[model samples]
Target: MTDSSPLDDNAFSHIMADPALAGSACSLAVACSGGPDSMALAFLLSRWCRDNGRRLTALVVDHRLRQESAREAETVGARLAALGVRVAILVREGPKLTRDLQNQARLARYGLMLSWCREQGAGDLFLGHHLDDQAETFLLRLARGSGVDGLSAMSPIEMRGGIRLVRPLLDIPKTRLVATLEQAGQAFVQDPSNLSDHFTRNRLRRLMPTLAEEGMDARRLADTAKHLSRARQSLEFYTSQHLNRSGRLYPHGFVRLERATFLEAPEEIRLRSLSKLVSALGGADYPPRFDRLQRLMKRLEADADGAGTLSGCQLLVRGGRIWLAREPSAVSGPVPLEGVGSFIWDRRFRIMLSATKKWPKETDFFIGALGIDGWRQWQNSGREISGFSILPAFVRRGIPALWRGDKLVCPLSTQKSDHWQDHGIEEIHLIAGELFGKTAFSSLNMRTM
Candidate 1:
């Protein structure tokens, strides 16, 4: 808690000791913005990586929202380079921002950074979200009427697309970060946008002092969020257990739930189970609204054979079970593939196209859902597909299929790897979304970090 002390090795090792990072002796990357928070983090990581005999890189994302963004990115690169850390300046390209500027920029920033990590073979990406950021996030989600999960704020470690997002400084104070930079004689830049009242975060930050006077200090707010995070962890554990017991997740990216068994669980578990089923099946980035989920739950309780749709997923009560599948109408349009390449269709399936001797050079190929028309074609063809015939009709409608315009090239059936090879595709590796591997809930280890 000392104001002027620099980040010590013990504090830094707490995060490095994480199980996710233990085997990740590969290079590490940090998102640097030239701000005190990120700069201090870069300084600490450079030293740690050097001592640990691992490489470290600083990734500066130039969002280009402001005219000086590019220059600031270069300045950050220069500073990190001086600290003996390799630097990569990533520029945000394509499409002009028109609305929801902050959110859009944030998404773009992460997209650029994560893509870099994947390309560079870095398995861990460190961030500089400190105690104040957690407190601000808590207030922001609270004002928006967030549920327990949302109010829990940021996690200390998050796994996204094979990359470990490690926030070692989440429990550290911003003042300490600034003091660290000062103590090291390191210079940092202040982003002008942060001072603007036009953003909600800035407004909330300005109100922090006043709120602290009213006894809702950053430490108290962050501690409350930590407690809620533990509660969310407990809820997630039960939700996972309930889902495993009551649901059967298929490789086709749909889930079948025993209606009575699912409904027999506690109401909170039921809601969370539904959320997980729909979110993963529909490939949605966020969960559906809590209010809408509650309404759906009530309807399911009242009507045993009810059919409902929410967040791009359809829920049908058929026979004695509940079926969750992507809504046919919400399925993404065909993705054109020129030749041998891998593509993610509807975010649910990974489709890889490999060229064979029979692969036609003049033909155009695409991947899309089978839909009603394709389903009919499949049915009438009398192909007697082993697995296709057994799938529920609603589930069949959303199955990923290979297409040449209107002609159904091939159905990406789970049991038909040889079938795809016959169509000049050597392999198509398809993994259903992470339906079963629900991550354990985590919070910052305050005693260590």
Candidate 2:
């Protein structure tokens, strides 16, 4: 932890040596906020890229919440440039101040950064959250009575859509980053918002010293986070394995799982298994609340049907199988397919369409908008309108396609539906919501063909 040596250099080298990154020339994007921790990360990553012949990009997100945010990003960009890192600055503008502004700002910031990484073809994005931050996050989650995953705080690596997010300095100390930055003659901007008591994190930081006095060292908290992370990873792995073995996709836009199998596992495993089952069925927007999950589990053990609904997803236990279903939204209606607009497909998905006279070449499945009419015409010819009457009217818009597999297929809901027989080229792009109860779709990694 010498001041003269870059603390993050060791970390960056170690991460590069990881089997995940070994021998592969991948572009790396660093999320820098002009803070000491991030600045040190950018400097070290820049040097590592230079030595390893890998491209490095630095991203600074200006939340635009504070008046000085733009200038701070510029200063951070200048500092990164001095360290030989290419920098990209993104400014997020929105309401100046409001309830939950911090959370909104965070979403916007990450949204801009991740979107930039995708657009730039970066394989991985690096963040500079250190041990102290992990400890703080753990404590906060603990105080809020979070589950194992929440208690796990931050993960070292996470896969979103197609981007791999890696935090190489999670084991390092914030003090070490500050010392390294100081020794490097780097001047980092101290965000005044961090010191303000307006945020829960700030309050936790203020209380950390007292908590540490009670024999809870920040290092110990960091260790706790690591332990939780390991435990969570194990639980998730087991859950995935079990789900693959026991879960089945059924018609009627529901996924079914054996209730007995889930109930027979250990409580933790049971909870995780159920959660994962619901998540897989719901897509990215279905995070089961702990209380709701507990209740659901109890009902599953009972003979009667017990159901829970959250964020437009429904979980029901019936006839020894648990079914997860997405609710149809009142917003379902046909709108003109003039150009690009977001159409809510039930509650679990939104379809975004960008139409052009000439085929707009990009990733995502595309089909003729009139294909639905063709299907109707075929149904009329075959006298199959009776069964087909139950089907929702398909509006002509842009071709339906996910960001993966350059094939025009039916919407995910249609694929999940029981009566979805035709896989024709329908001019509708299905933008599925977060499968878990996460609010933002930006966290998802969109694959390009």
Candidate 3:
């Protein structure tokens, strides 16, 4: 590791100047693990928050993967608390997974931390992912034959679950973080797992030295990632413009694309636009395989009046418009809605219960898709079906519905007449995560040197 100087407030102050962060309140949160990197971040944020007259909280997540994990969490809390930083210890409790332990742990950690941020009214979350982490991620993705977007590595800023995840240390090296801690005479813990070769990252870490001997180093790899990031940014900017010009996202969780507008775009833009539409409407965490996307594009060009399905979404072209809607067969099975609180069902709808209202104690409610059976019942009952006549029959059947046993209680629709006053429903929003209408593609330019 190269000798580096300790970081100061100036290293983090520029993050506050971002216009995207202007909407956030005067409170910030940081993820700390009691390690040199996170510990240094927590200390730096503590002083910065104090000087800026803002509130800061350090969140430590206990994955409970090891026997000492819980105690380690408390130890992290103590260290942050001693630095005059508020600390919250979040525990991940559930059955342990035997496969993909590291990936599972990461998902669980973010789940707990983001939930806490929403509860505490913190809009921005700071993470200590330094240059080495970005370099490792680049090499890993490159090995996997990832495209430009994946190989661009991590961003300095990202929006997750409506929270701004800020990584101000992406340009800083791990040695600088260690130096920062040593300059302040602070003690930090090292995670033993980092040294184990069982994990893919640790294996890559070992190879880094050998690769550096041949003129491939961390700084060079990270710089290549930044260069690719700019190219990715340009592609995303044009893709966003194409999506906005060619499609309309309906409140009923469907998209209508102008047939000619969609087909006329360049091949790359068309693939990207289709990928975004499917991922958002299908609520899939990742985009479909590139080959699958390419194949689907070819089919769309061949068949003007055909239907195809991918990533839990159905794409159909009829009457010169391409209709993208949720695949009814792929809809999540019924989920029990037991309490008077907000819940996200099927990752596509948000159902918020009225805290002031209570339901009958003897009844149980469930949220599921308005399948053909539910639509038949609604139609047979002579309930104003004309209000939903504008939407396609298949699209209407896939919308969210409330059920009491087998009886359909409410079918959420785009019509203005639907209400849940009797059931104490406060609000329902179509919240397909990262859907076309919900968000546009964005990027920020960052200098690594």
TM-score of each: 0.76, 0.67, 0.76
Compared with the true structure, what per-residue lDDT tens digits does model 2 show for residues 195-273?
A: 9998889999988778788867678898887788898877776665565555543222345567777566778877776
lDDT of 1 by residue, 249-305 (tens): 665667777888989998888899888777767655567888898999898888878
For 213-267, candidate 3 gives per-residue lDDT tens digits of: 9878888899999999999889977887887677766656777888888898999
How large is the C-alpha RMSD of every model relative to the true structure?
Answer: 6.7, 8.2, 6.4
Instruction: Return the number of clashes found in candidate 2.
Output: 18
Q: How close is candidate 1 to the true structure, as a TM-score?
A: 0.76
lDDT of each: 0.78, 0.61, 0.79
